[model samples]
Target chain A: MVKLTADNIEMRFGERLLYRFQHLSLAQNQTIHLQGDNGSGKTTLMKMFAGLIAPSSGEINIQGADSLPWWRRNPLLGKAVYLHQHPYLFEGSVAANLSYVHSLCEGDKATIMARTEQAAKLAQLDHLMQQNAANLSGGERQRLAIARAWIMQPKLLMLDEPTSNMDKLSQELVLTLIKDLQKQGTGMLISSHQACVLTQLCNQMWKIEQQGLTSTQHTPTMAKYSNTGQSQEFSYVTAS
Target chain B: MNDGWLALIQQALSLLFSLDPEVWSIVSVSFSVSFAALAITLIPSLILGFILAFGRFPGRWLVTNLIQTLQSIPTVVIGLLVYLMLTRMGPLGDLKWLFTQKGMILGQMLICAPVLVAMSQAAFTSVDRRAWETSRTLGASWARAVWTVCRELKVPLLMAIVAAFSRILTEVGCSMMVGGNIADVTRNIPTAIALETSKGDFAQAIALGLVLLILSLVLNFTLGTLRGKAEPRSH
Candidate 1:
């Protein structure tokens, strides 16, 4: 089942063009890795795909929803979620952050509570439920954010640099949780610099090159050793 | 240092603490008028501030600049403009609100609306844009997203409210011109202070001054407390 489709997507700020895409589509349970340099418009594309931003000229249809301006009143809501590189942890306990996602639904209190608990455990945040999310360490906050997003059970989840600030252990845990979500049929688009690790879970790889999206399939490994003896894999996809 | 000054201050304190009826009456009127003005402008100012902060439209900069400019305009100029409007020969004459508490409220509201708008806009602008996007991505309505942003900015919003309140509460020019300083009706604290001082009734003037000083201190204290509460949660 197709979860989302974008046709002729283009984004520009005034006279400066950011990116343009001919077409893109996501199927149920598909995981796509998006790789790009710092200023290559990767985050902007994800935001537009999630309906958080309007494209300069294009149509992005999510779950057959009409197009941009997908308001909360739109039924397409609760079906998609986007996590920023540095997600905002609201001014409250970590539990409150998880509960916020459940609050948006129309379920009974007990059912929502169960889901929140389940999400917390999945993200390995069950012990930090009472802690203030704002004061949490970077990895814990990212885990909390993922748990919060999972509780909503969005069909399509877009994550920007979900593991950038995480330690190797934390990154492994996050990828494990994401793999679990994929098994349950959650389509995902992830933007990250850790290509070797992320590509392992990706079925499709997309990169921004020459102001447009370039598609590739997952390679056996993007782990290439550089002359400096550092493990740098993916080529830096800079803007033209 | 002077015995006469100390004596006058003592008399003023005695009258203030003794619940002098005439002095209390002016204080009551002051509170009522300023509170009314704030109540009238609060909702509209918040709405305009949010629009200015987040809404993308042509001429947004012009509107923001206009509100900022209005905030710095002299209170007496606003008083004079409102006076012309409320005078018998002016456009709003038929309301017959001149020299009434309502007229003072109207003048104060005029002075406060832009002040509230400018400050609240700055507060809203300071909120992380990610908050809005995250809320919407989580299925919050636009209004709910805006409300969440406001929740995140409770401290700054309170400061804006306190600022607008203080500006109208202590301003004498608008109150004097439009309220006409009528005793038992429009004789608010600032107008009363001005009148009493000119009339050489130092006791009354000093008492009103003391009241203003306490009010300002209380407001700053509350602002400081809010800042303390907000620091840990703010990013």
Candidate 2:
């Protein structure tokens, strides 16, 4: 099955054109990691592929549907979930938050609870479900975000900085979930500055630089070589 | 007048609870017109504010500054400006909305639209960009993205509405001039206060004042609750 394709997608921010994409595709069951300096349009690229944005000048065909320039939502897209760097948690119970935008139909109370339980187990968020999502710690937030995506059973999963707020242990758990997703034939795209995200699990890694995306590989020297060498190369940071 | 304090207190209490057809008329009219005007401006201001804050359109700053200046223009000035164009002799005279509830609603919308735009824009602008990006990547449509942003900023939006409501409710000049404070017709809280005080009905004036205070309190309480729950990426 064709996973996803963004053909010649161009996005402009005012006079500055941000990205020009030509033939980017993800195969079913493949994992791709996106990397970039701050404001290099990594998030924009991810959002474009996620179908959240209109490319200024191109088309994004997903799962065989003709790419739409305007807002496009599909029931199948629910089969693909995007977890933002900072997940937008609704004001509600933990279970309610987990079910947000997720269309798990015809399920009884027990089934819903079971699925919720399973998702929490993968994200290790079971203990925190009853807690107010607003008060969750950073690590806890990431876990809940992933757990929500996990419950949706998306064929395509995209995560932006899933472990930015987590410690080594939490990051390891996130990576483990990615491994499971790839094993289950879910194509995953992760945008991260962290070296760990571009693991052996990811078949390809790409980086955004000067308004363009170039293929990158995180060798063993990823940590020591990444930001330290190009400290001055990217002086501008995207204000959160 | 002889029992000044007692009479004032009684008069105030009476004006508050008496709820004569006139008082009820005024109260209902006030709410209806202000509510109508607010409803009319809600979507426009929201969309304008959203685009101004988040969109990369040219001359966006000019629009923002112009709106800010318009917001600071006094309510009386707004009433005068509209009164001119809407008068029997003015351009849009055929509508015959002058001194009518609809007229007042139009005038007040002019007053409140800016507040709604500036405040709501600030609120929406304050929402984390991640929320927008996340919603976008989820393959949500523009409408869905806007709805997501609105939901995320619902607390602020609520507060902005209350602020606009309270601002219009207490302004005497517009309701008086534009609504003409017609007895048992277009009279509202502020206009009623003016009429009662001018007619030496200090007791009634005090009563209307008390009601206005209570209304303001309710509005504030609602805004406070929404602000509390509107956790905008506090984490």
Candidate 3:
């Protein structure tokens, strides 16, 4: 199983400290909800795990992956995929973006082509394949970004505020895609300040507050809807 | 006087259409020398530009400023420097490149490199950071990722190349000093134009001038089409 572990990690920018965590490990079949307020380094932490940046002081190790060649500098890259808050879609049509990522994936030609088509359909972007990705709506852009990663079927995925600014229908669409990936045992670390449809899927929580990080077992309170959808009951519980 | 001007224009067109050997030879020399210099300097200058834009090292700011300063120095000054370096008593005297095409190419390289580097650096710096991150995270090799970013900035990078080529191709001082403007040997369009004008051969000068004008129009229009196609990115 793919795994990532960080030990005694501390992040700092100039003289200001961001956060410090003693030990953390994420492995396949584990889904985590990373919670923090604005500027609490949520994005920074996700980028760190994605190997896009280095922490001030710490070692991060990835296990159960093929050995990278000497020329491949960062071992953590391609190990986990990180989606930005406002996803960056390449300059092209939706089909072109999907084809771009499809070229990077390791699979037979036919299988990858099939996966690309399936990803587009799952993200509800099949009809918009010929449209310019730059002209896509905010939700469509995020969906396209996630669809690109979904083609790879990455072992781990980090979503940074994936649902923010998304309409309810778009959020539900993204939730469906994430739910499929979870069923396929893709480890996920989703960062959001408030509980959303995606946060309900996490079995564990990591919260950053006052320059410290805490981990806990979480059982998210699911909203129960009536047939008329007029009244709802809310419940909250957590296990330390 | 108007009739004299009309006759000169007619003669210029005739020389060009007839493919007059001397005029075409000078045109050939200009293109060959400029092309050689651009070919030799293109990859190295772009690599340096990329490093300046992305790599962090000591003296980076100083180097960037130095290149910016170099871009504005007069071509005549560069010609003089190359002349001194290639002169008999100079350090490079043993190579004996003085007053030769090699010497002209060397001078043009110095004239073009700074333009390529500075403009390319600006283009690279203007690229979104997420382009690189997205490529790397999507499992592209380092070289592939750089290529992708270059693809994304193709218009600007190509404009840099065209700007550098135009600068070197139109420069007269360096070719005159370092190449000696010898007929059928090292003479180029700009130097030939300067020579023909001075010798009252207005037809040949105007012919060469037309060639430069046409080339400039073509390059600019091509770049304009490309820039028009590259829609402004949203994020």
Candidate 4:
């Protein structure tokens, strides 16, 4: 079992401190929806979790392994994957792009092909498997990027604004897939503005603002009136 | 002008087809020296280019500046300095490189190395950093990462080499000053053209000059095509 933990972390870029958090831990398979306004530290914190940026003053520890590299520190980084807003695609056909990622491995061709298909199905990208990825539409391209990330069999999946370009149906498919994947022990961190998408799937919505990150405790009582007239339950709006 | 051009073209074609041993020898020797110098430049420039692109050191800027400055130093000046060094009483006098094809090759290597380094560093820097980081994260060592980048940037790198070779092959001043146009020995196309033109043998010089222009054009065209092909594909 892999647990993600950060102890008293302060993040800084150049001479400016972005934000600081104390003891952020995910003990189980949790789907976290990070909600924040633009320029708030949501992306920054997600980047830190993805091991793309190291914390200025803190310790990120993978509870099981002591000396693994930062990526390995969180299994998501090793077996997990991060999909950026503008995902970088390799230059080639979909087959070439898929095969290129697997080419570095010592595995058999069948294994690679099977995993590619499996990922394509999970990400609802089976239709465009043969098309040149560069020629895909915006939503198709985002799904293709999702398919690419899924092919990695990540223990942790972090997405920055995934499905921002996807259609409503595609968004539901992705959200359902994320929930299913998380249920099977893959933790997901999705940063998106679609609050309605997460109302059903996300166990918790962590909001980030100029102040800091705050955990909204999701008790069963809160779930009863999610779509009802009780809209004033909590201060859920963050503007400016 | 048309009559003169037609006559020059006819004469050049005849000279080229006559199997004149002098033309053949100079062309052969020039290619040999140019290719030799180009081969010598490849390793040092690759190493230096990789360093300049990726390695950070205290004197990195200074070293790059010096190399770029050397690139602009006229070939004649390079020849004169080399001529001095390899002269009878100079530091490398015992080696006797002056007035030889070896001297020409050495001079061309100096002329081409900096160009290769500058172009290659630009090519390498243009590679995507994601590929670099991915290879490293996947357990490929530093050497492997560099090899991957090189493999991906092969076409651009080849174009740079071709451009360098073409430049060295067409340059006259250094080849003349150092090779001394030693009739059938160190004489190559450009230096021979210079001598032929100076002696008012416009026919022979025109033929050689036209060939030089053709070579330069072909190399430049190939470089442009290769660059176009390699750009969108570069990671």
- The candidate maximizing TM-score is 3
Q: What is the C-alpha RMSD of each candidate to the true structure, in Å?
A: 4.2, 6.4, 2.2, 5.6
Predict model 4's lDDT versus the native: 0.71
- Residue-by-residue lDDT tens digits, candidate 2, A3-95: 777778789988998877577876567777687878888777766666666679987766743354444444334435677777776666577
- DockQ of the two-chain complex in candidate 3: 0.73
Clashing pairs in 4: A76-A80, A79-A154, A80-A154, B128-B235
Give the TM-score of chain A in candidate 3: 0.94
Interface RMSD of each: 2.2, 3.4, 1.1, 4.6
Best of the two (2, 4) by DockQ: 2
| Sort order, TM-score high to low | 3, 1, 2, 4
lDDT of 4 by residue, A108-192 (tens): 8898789788877876677777777667666666666666555554566677787665566566566656666777777777787
Could you give candidate 1's per-residue lDDT for residues B72-186 as a string of tens digits? 9889999999999999999999999999999999999999999899999999988889888888888887788878899889889999999999999999998999999999999
Stretch of 10 with least lDDT, candidate 1 chain A = A222-231
- Candidate 1, pairs of clashing residues: none
What tens digits encode model 3's per-residue C-alpha lDDT throughout B70-153? 999999999999999999998888899999999999999999999999999999999999998988888888888888889989
For model 2, the TM-score of its B chain against the native B chain is: 0.92
lDDT of 4 at B15: 76
In every candidate, what fraction of the native interface contacts is reproduced?
Answer: 0.72, 0.46, 0.63, 0.00
Residue B154 C-alpha lDDT in model 2: 81
**Model 2 lDDT per residue over B1-235, tens place:** 4788788988678766767666667778888888899899888998998998888988999999999999899899989988997899999899999999889999999999899999998998888776775565454556877887788778888888888878887887877888888887789888887888889878767777777788888878877877776554565
Of candidate 3 chain B, the 10-residue stretch with the lowest lDDT total is B226-235
Docking outcome class, model 3 = medium
lDDT of 4 by residue, B1-235 (tens): 6998788878876777786677778788888999999988898898899899888889989988888788789888888888888889989889999999898998898889988998888888887766664444333445666777786687778878887887799888889888999988899998898888889777787767766787778877876786675435311
Q: Look at candidate 3 and give me any clashing residue pairs.
A: none
Quality of model 1 by C-alpha lDDT: 0.83
Docking class of 2: acceptable
| Candidate 3 lDDT by residue in tens digits, A1-240 | 999999999999999999999999988899998989999999999999999999999989889877999999798898888998988888878999999876678889999999999989988999999998889999999999998998898889999999888877677789888988999889999998887767778889898999999988877667332334122332447775
